[model samples]
Target: MSRPALEVADVFRSHGPAWRRAHAGHVSLDQLKVMSAIERCRTAALGGHVARCADCAYTSIAYNSCRNRHCPKCQGAAAKDWLADREADLLPVPHYHVVFTPPAAVADIAYQNKAVVYDLLFKVSAETILTIAADPRHLGARIGITSVLHTWGSAMTHHPHVHMIVPGGGISLDGSKWISCRPGFFLPVRVLSRLFRRLFLEKLMAAYAAGRLNFFGDHALLADTQAFATHLAPLRRSEWVVYSKRPFGGPEAVLAYLSRYTHRVAIANSRLIAVDEQGITFKWKDYRIEGHNRHKRMTLATDEFIRRFLIHVLPKGLHRIRHYGLFAKSACADNVARARELLTVAKPEGEPTSAAVDPNKPSCPCCGGRMIIIEVFARGATPRHQPTAPTNRIRIDTS
Candidate 1:
């Protein structure tokens, strides 16, 4: 496939320095770092090395990647590596995709209190699902959940939601057998929605009472206790969005879904149509419009585009992807093994695992030879007669 003509890196490379200068003291250090990383990614600013094909002598200067989590240019390889690590963790059963979204009001408050509110979001959403599924009236089992938090909507708006991938079954409370949810269905959305609203609001009110949340800008008035309560009053009665899609066809489909959903940025390089002096033009989906008009193109001035993108940068070191219940990191391995054994399913033979990679070698495009590093170069240095065909290469080690 042909690479997209315009990329997020191009926009930043051309306009990022000016944006940083214009917003100097106003921008967060994290945001500024992201801009710098994107502007210099896969370029000489970060340094690189030269690789020569053994068979064809195809030599090239392969620049290093910024590997910044927030960079759109850097997530493709990360997603692939992540998927490979998770290959051994897949359960042989149906899986469901559940989404828990904060109402517009909560999202407004969450903007300023990202760390606190987002932490609560992960906690409450997972608790709600696990709690409901554990009830005798519901599925009555201990389910596994993998939730990924997304802070932006299709139009790059501040919409916060958690996307969870869950097995349609769980271990029995007695730890004797696997309990399967009915085929094609998971939990009831209405039940999940109601409980999610209560749990989130109750916890949020506690956070407010304890003074853990910070309110600023137009919401500054919320610093007052009474005002905060009044702000949450309407939301308490409103429905919080919680919905689940039909079960995935099989484990393979679940992997495919995770590959796209997890590690996704606000937008991809391929989605960008054009970048120029006027602004950026990219495809955006309008969920409210419905039908063919929903997928349409929109243009934003350079400044506004940068603002929208940075808003989703997230608090530094915050984990956007998380695991809980059976999938929780602490004991997921033992639990998964037990569940698989209960289902009388042995781990599939030769499950297409990723081989141990050699970081120093680059494969030859001409005759598929293992190309080795011939020389290393420092940051901002130019190589003499560097080959550029094949377009992409990875740099390993510095001389």
Candidate 2:
């Protein structure tokens, strides 16, 4: 794909220093590191390599990626690599997409206490599904889940939620037969919503009692036990948001959907229309509106844009994508094999399951011959030969 005219890296490189000075001590170390990495990504500051076509001798420079999970330029390759590994695990059964979201008031608390509350969001949501599915009243089988946490809405606001991909059925409790939900349906949304609300609030309060949550600035008053209880009182009666989409058309559709979401950053370069004296302009979907009118454009001052972008930089070492139940890393292989066996379906055949070509190796643009790396360049070093044309740029549409 061709390079985007503008990028987050460009915005960071131009205004990041001033933004850092203005924020001073308010920015977290993780956010600062993200800014630095995006600014240096695919630039001479991080070095690169020279690759030449064996037949035509055409040369190109391929800069090294920062490989930061939050970098827009780095996630396409990462998602592709990850999806390749997951392809073999997909079952022939239908797959469902379910979302779990907290109320705005709860989101406020989550913003203040991200680590503790986000962890709760993942655990409670998974537990809710597992508990409900295991009930004889529901599916009565142990289901597997792959959950991905998204912390931003289309406008880059703090809207924390978990998106789970679950096979339409699961292994029976006794591990003897495959249990599948009724065709065209997964589980009842109302039951899932009520249970999720109850469990999340219960655990959130417990986290507060254990002194694992923190409040600051406008929420400083929540530090008090009575104030916290009063704040949560209204949420107790309100319903939480838990909804499931219609099952995907097939396993191929599921793979296509997962590719788009697995490694997304706050915003993609394609969504960026312009960055000029008027501020940063970008496209966003106003979900409140329906039909064609939903797509809209908005602009924000450079400082505000940078601030909003950095709001999504996750805490260091927190895993955004997680697997639970049958998909759990420890028992995934065995469990999947058993599921295929019970279903009486053989593993996908014919084509090579692995990616046909390594993304790191590119075909020659001039002669369609293999490109071989001729030299390695260290960080801050320039390559011996500059490319006659721009090298392939990885593009991911995160919007």
Candidate 3:
């Protein structure tokens, strides 16, 4: 993958401080922290180490990463490490991709009530899929679902949706056999859509009645029960969007898709085109349009672009990726184990290994040897001058 000329970090490093000053007290602390982390990521501001190739005597400086989940530059490694652990969980079966998006009217309400609405989204959508799939009329099995929450559209607009990767078949209710759905078909999207719409609206109204939801700005009038009911009237009648893409070729395809979307931020660094006096320009897809016409560029004032990005910073400690039904964390491992056994496939050797590694460690560019830190330096401090000595360890400095 060739590096893009512009990156999300570049945008923040240039205009972040100015935007912070202008919008002081208006942004969330988490959003401000995200801006600060992105601006300083992999820069001297965060401190770093010097790594040298032991064989050929090549040297390089590697700065520490911010590791913020919202940082575009940080998610790559996070995804890679996460996928390593998930690799063992892949059953030898086809996987389906389904997306459930709330209507624009409900999306507006969800913007203000993010915690409640987002939680409801995951709950209702997962329930809808599980409930409908277990019915004899549909797949007639308890399916596993790995759902990821995405809150932005191609243009960085606030569009909340759940992307689900489901196995093509599931365990029968009696746990006696593996039940597979018809090839090239998962479930009827219309059935899923109607169930999702009805369930989401029901729970949302219940939350409103319990006073667990808050309305602000233009939606403040919805604080009243009658007004809130009236506000949701249109949403109730509107068709919720639920569509499933073609089933992936195999388990490997599912892994590839997970690597891309599971840890993705609202906008990747590669999508950024330019930043200038006018604004920041980036490529965006108009999904409403078709083919080449859908690929277009968009520019927003730097502040507005930052605003749009911040809208996607999820609440603290919220889990964006979740598993439901058979894939539910409580039983996922057991379920995968059983599924593999039923399919007459043996678990791979050394299955379920944790592939976690130190994020700051660097490898030699020429020799590919692990670089060791032989010296310590504080932020902005220069390395000390020392007599050259024959040693295998790579001398390092924070500066």
Winning model by lDDT? 2
When summed lDDT is taken over every stretch of 10 residues in candidate 1, the lowest stretch is: 390-399
Per-residue alpha-carbon lDDT of model 2 for 129-204, expressed as tens digits? 9999998899999999999999999989999999999999999889989999999899999999999999999999
lDDT computed for candidate 3: 0.85
TM-score of each: 0.94, 0.96, 0.92
lDDT tens string, model 1, 133-230?
A: 99978899999999999999987989999999999989989998899998888999999999999999999999988889998889999999889889
lDDT: worst 10-residue window of model 2 = 390-399
* Alpha-carbon local distance difference test for all models: 0.86, 0.90, 0.85
| Residue 40 Cα positional deviation in candidate 3, in Å, after optimal superposition | 1.5
Off by over 4 Å in 1: 1-3, 289-291, 349-353, 356-362, 388-399
Rank candidates by TM-score, best first: 2, 1, 3
The clash numbers for all candidates, in the given order, read 0, 0, 0
Clash pairs (backbone) in predicted model 1: none
